[model samples]
Target: MAEPSITIRDNGPYVVTMPVEILDAKGNPLTITRERITLCRCGASNNKPFCDGTHNKINFESQVSA
Candidate 1:
């Protein structure tokens, strides 16, 4: 099995490699149909928990490395 990976995009979302499950606050599962997923980080996406390019519109900035 391949290990999952996660990448943080510049001023954008968290790009996640799948075979993973995402649960809502209510513990309900969110449908994941893609090989990878883009999760919101800037808290501006109308589509909560997913990236809708709101970070670009809002000019969100972040510096992180690991």
Candidate 2:
């Protein structure tokens, strides 16, 4: 398997490309059926921990570089 990568988008959610196990607060595994997923960063999604395109609605702004 290739190493997983997490990419920070331009004012958007973090894009993850890899098979992963998502956990809840109690350490319970959250079901993820896809290798590619978008994680919420703007804290505006009705679906917590996942991106639901709410950032675009709220006009969220963030830019990070290495």
By lDDT, the best candidate is: 2
Model-by-model lDDT, in order?
Answer: 0.88, 0.91
Candidate 2 structure quality by residue, lDDT tens digits, 1-66: 656889999899999887777789999998887878999999999998999999999999999999
Number of backbone collisions per candidate = 0, 0
Candidate 1 per-residue lDDT, tens place, 1-66, comes to 456888898878999998788899899999888888899999999998899988998999986788
Off by over 4 Å in 1: none
Regions of candidate 2 where Cα sits further than 4 Å from its true position: none
